[model samples]
Every structure is written in C-alpha cells, then in structure tokens.
Target: MQTVKYFTQDELASLFKAIKKKKSKYWLRDYCIFRVAYRCALRASEVGLLTVAEYNAQRSELYCNRLKNSQNNTIRLDDETKKALEKYIRDYGIDDCLFPSQVSKPISRQTLDLLMRKYCKVAKISDKKKWHFHSLKHSVAVHLADSGLDVKELQHYLGHKNVNSTLVYFQFTTRQQDNMYKKLEQRNYLV
Candidate 1:
C-alpha cells in the first residue's frame, strides 16, 4: 500500500479553491465528496455507506459505522459539511443512502473511486497516491494535531483501541528536524 502524505495548509486551501471553481455539477459532487472525506476522516466506504438519516437533525451530529472495526461513530457536524450533505440529500433524495446510484441503490466502492479520480483530475492531484479513503483520516489527524489536540484526545476521537495508532498521524505531519525552530529565538526583552 502506498503511503499518503499530509498536505501543507496552503496546499489544502488551494485544492479546496480548485474544487470550488465554477465548473460542472460533477465538480460540486466532487467538492462535496472530498470535503466530506477530508473533514470527517471517514473511509470511502463509510462515506458511500452514509444515509441522510445518519445525520441527527435535532443535534446536528453525523453518524457512520467504523470501517474494518465494528465500532459506531457520531461526530459533531461542520457547517460547510452540513450544507453539502443537506444539499446532496435534498437534490438526490437518498434518505436511505447518503451516497447513491442512479438505480436507487447504495453507491459502490468503484463508483466512489471514480468520483475521487474525477476530482483529483480537475485538481491536478495524484490519483496513484494512497490518499483515497482512510487518507482522509490521516488528514483529519494532522488537522487536529495542528490545532494542538493531545494524543489522548485524538485516540478517543479516532476510536483507536490503542494510542499508538494515533501516533502514525503525528509522524505523517512531523516536520524535518531542520525545519524546527525555537520560539525563544526572539531578542531578549524582559518587559
């Protein structure tokens, strides 16, 4: 399996901008898919498996079944994500399946991959990279680390049985030693 690297903040912002351009309906779906994937840190299957009802309307929380593990997860919704999901649900009426097919069935993994490829093409990102499903999990992990979340907190958020699983994400975002600098380098001013 290829390793997925973390994107710099600016790079991520640029990709978001790329997906937001006035392109086609496909781009809209692409944007929604990418944003949901990156923001929620869900596996591709989880994203495709989601249903409109997975969103708790009253609490504004989103739910998904953890992939590879039998755990269940519910997280507070992001505004942009909520908007995208709401739009998709309203437009498609896939109350039973958050991701849908024209035949009124759950979206297949292959279809999800195709959607991913289309977006990556427009954004000029690498499709060969292992940045598909769980890569989003890595992205979220980096984001949380950047936000100063502790490893313990992340362990719980990620639903990891062990804290070591969360460490991999930190490793992904860790800068080279040369890139590290002391904040205390400022001129001495004991004011």
Candidate 2:
C-alpha cells in the first residue's frame, strides 16, 4: 500500500499561523487560497483556475472546477473560509480571478508550490520537501476519512470519478487501526 503525504491538523494550523505572521501585501490572499484549497480538497491547478464569480456569497458556496476528468462540484464554505474570502474580496477589490498575479493572470501552479515551500519553512515543519500544495487535498481527504465519512460520500466530496480513486485513503492508518481495536475492545471481541 502506498502512503499518502498529507499535513496533520497541527501542521496545518502552524502553516496558517506562519502565513498570518507574514507582512506581505498578498498575505490574506495566500491565507484564503490555502484555506479554501484544504477545505475543498482542490488541486493546485484547480485552485489557480478559480474565479471570483464562482464564489456565491449569499449561498456561502464555492463552485469547484475539477480537472483531470474529475467531476465538478460546488462545496459549501466553512465559516472561517467564508469570512476570509469575503475579507480578501473586499480588501483587494478583486474583479475576476480569485488569486491574480500582478500581470492580471491567474497565479501559476509553480507559484503555489513556491508559496507552500515558503510557508512550510517559516512554520518549521520537518521534512518540508514532502509537503507540496497537493498535500492540502490529501490532508483533507485523509482527515475526513478518519472522521468516519463513508467511502461513497468521500468519493463524491473529492469528486473522484471512481470509488477506487477514493479507496486509497481507506488503507487504515495507525490511528484508524487503533480506533478499530478500541471499538473491538469495547465490544469484548477479544474475549
């Protein structure tokens, strides 16, 4: 079984904190971008393609345009993401792209990778080379699976074209195995 690389909740919190401490003009935009990417389980390219119009403020929803033949879906925004997005939109007066470069183009995937590396370094996350922008998607998928989301549901949430694509996350981490053992113990299955 192949192990998926992902950020733990603690690491994600630390990363966001590091991003917040940065004094750059794009700080809020970067913060919101990462937050949304994690929450929506979006690929870096998908995130780059995001547009301001895709955010439905009144409905508190974001329409994700999935790539690589994945199904596209609209995800409801969490309170933190919603608030951050609203503030970013208001502060930046963004008209088109959700994350635009100075040249008025969508931020490139390479730029996203660089930003991830920069923030991971600032957060002092060990094995920083293992954590790329795609880790946000894997992190959310793993976290959601560990939270007891069903495979079908997780598949839909991730916009996986096939359940097999989502099944990799069910490989049972050590934490998940421990949980199973605890559940069996509570049922006296070992007896």
Candidate 3:
C-alpha cells in the first residue's frame, strides 16, 4: 500500500504564509478555505460544496455535508478558523458560496485541485506530486493523533465509518516511532 502523506505543522504554517503573499483578490477567500479544510479535516469536494449558510457563527460550528460517503458531520470551529472565515465573509461580502467562481457558483473540484497546486508551489512543498488535497485531512488526523487524541475520537472527528480507516494514518515511520517513544519516556509511561 502506498503510504499516506501528511504535512508537519510548520509546513502548514509555511503554506498559509505563501498564500498571504499572493496578490490576488481571492487570497482571503482561499486562505479561509484552506484554514477551514485543515481545521475541519474536510475532503476537497466537501470544501468545494461548503456554503456560508453552513456556518453557525454564534455557535462556532460548521455543519459539513461530506460528498463521498454522504456523511453529515458537525465540526466545532476553532477560534482561529472562526475569525478567519468571519473576516473573509465580511470583507468579500460573501453571502452565498464560501468559495465562489466569477459566475457566482461554488468552485469546482478541478479548481480546488489547481489552487492547492499553486499554493503548494508557492510554499515550495517538497515532493508535491506525492501529496494531494486530501493530505490536509491526513495532516489533521496525524497531528491530532500525535498530540494524544484517542483513535476512537479521531475516527469520529474524521467522519470515518470504519475504525481501520483511521488506523491507517497512525502507521508511523521510523522517525515517528522514535518520537512516540521519546514522548512516552518523558511522560514516564515507558515502565
């Protein structure tokens, strides 16, 4: 099986910085979409289908209707994601689709793919070909897993119907294995 690829937190930060340097008017919208995807661990199609109506600003939550498995997930919005989305909505006067085309329609999957490529190029992400838009979702899962989130909870968070789907992401590499051991030792859990 091909190993799943994921970004480290520093790489994610670099991507956002690269997006910020773009001169396009859609930078805010793009950044908001990227942030929401990473934070919510959304699929590209799910992110494309997202509309402003899904966001409950008062509750700081998003009602995500994922396209692949027809899963309806209620995701809690972090303050950073909430603020970025709120500002994008306000600044762009976006009252309909969150990421809209010039024709005022939801951006297509192709467009989302192209956008990821563009930003990844700007960020100078290594071996970009091996990574896809779904890597953001993997990144969230792996990062949260490394931070000690229970696999069961991570499964629910990723909206995976099967626990095995979530388990694949935790198949650690040698460096990750070492890191996990070090973390356990620091917590005195090695005994």
Candidate 4:
C-alpha cells in the first residue's frame, strides 16, 4: 500500500520553512532528506538507506543506489540543494549514514516515513496521505520534464531500465503527439 504525492516547488518550499523553524538540528536533517527525494527523484527507501560516501561535493553529484528502480544513479545537485546538504553534514557530522539515529545507526525507512507524516501534520497540510514519502522522487522527474529536459536525458537521470519508463514520467496529451507527427510528415517532400 503506497501512496503517491507530487510537491509543487511552492509546496516543497513551504514544507522546508515549516521544518526549519525548529531549534534542534533535526530540521536540517529533514531538509537534506527532502532534497534528496525532491531533487533526485529517489525512492524513500533509497534516500534513507544512502551512505555518506556516496556524495561527491566537488562534482556536485549524489549517488543513490536504488533498489526499487533496480539501478544506481548519479544525480546532479543544484546549488540550493547542495548548500542545504552542506549545512546538514556540518551540523549532523559526517558518518556513514546521511540521516542517522542517536547511536549513529542509519535510520530505518519506516522511521523516515513516520517522521514525514508528523511534519506534514504540523504544517496543516491536506491530502497528506497522497503525498507519501516516495512522491518526492516522482516530483523530481516530473519537474525535469516540465523544465524541458529531453526524454533520453531524463531516462538516465532516473535510472530507468528503458526509455519506455521515461515516457510514464511525463504527461502527454494527444494533441501534442499529433502536432509532432504532423511536423515529421511536413519534413518529407512526399507532401
């Protein structure tokens, strides 16, 4: 039973603001966790299970070993997300786990799921169940498509097994397809 939700940029920002107000370092913790999902389109379990060594600050790339998607991918980190991760690492201390327990144990996937629910509740967010932790990843892929990234480019970023999977990541209308086919037809002198 998995619920899926998409976060608009505004919604993502709102959640960040709500979580950042806390006095403890947990907010930073949650923020980095959020960025990984929102930016990389990684599954909740993949983000939670990530080890610290996977981050390459100089390259501005984040390596997420995905199980659900069954492929490991290197996600490019935008500046804002990179900064947030830097702060998280500085405050949380860089050990093995990016988000670790008090005893330095990696947080379980279930723990992150529960925490996100609590965060959503505090902010009075609705459709809360719809935006389960995995939606963050979905939002990222959708955003990439919305931003005009070509299907092949998005395919690699998402670590999808085939180009067909990338097709599902984007929303297409019949008119758009007809227009493209018409344009292709126009290119031939057979008109």
lDDT string for model 1 (1-191, tens) is 23456555665666677778836655566677777767666766777777777788667687767776635667777888778767767775556776666576776777776665555566677644633545557778777876767778777677676776777766554442223333333434323
lDDT of 1 at 158: 71
Ranking by lDDT: 2, 3, 4, 1
lDDT of each: 0.66, 0.90, 0.83, 0.74
Per TM-score, the best of the predicted structures is 2
Give the residue spans of candidate 3 off by over 4 A. 173-191
Q: Is candidate 1 or candidate 2 better by lDDT?
A: 2
Q: Model 2 over residues 25-105: C-alpha lDDT tens digits?
A: 899999999999999999999987899999999999999999999999999999999999999999999979999876889
Q: For model 2, where is the 10-residue window of minimal lDDT? A: 170-179
TM-score of each: 0.77, 0.92, 0.86, 0.81
The local lDDT score (0 to 100) that residue 136 gets in candidate 3 is 88
Give per-residue CA lDDT, model 4, range 1-191, as digits (tens). Answer: 23235777677676777777654557778778877777887777777677779889899898978785466888889998899998788876776888776667776667777767777766556876544787677777767777767788888888887787777766632444565678888997345
lDDT against true structure, model 2: 0.90
Put down candidate 3 lDDT per residue, 1-191, tens digits, no spaces: 54878888888998889888995878888888888998889988888688889999999998887765645788999898899899989988988888887788878767877888899999989877534788888889888877767778888888888788888877743445777799999999979
Write out the backbone clash pairs for model 1. 50-98
lDDT of 3 at 38: 88
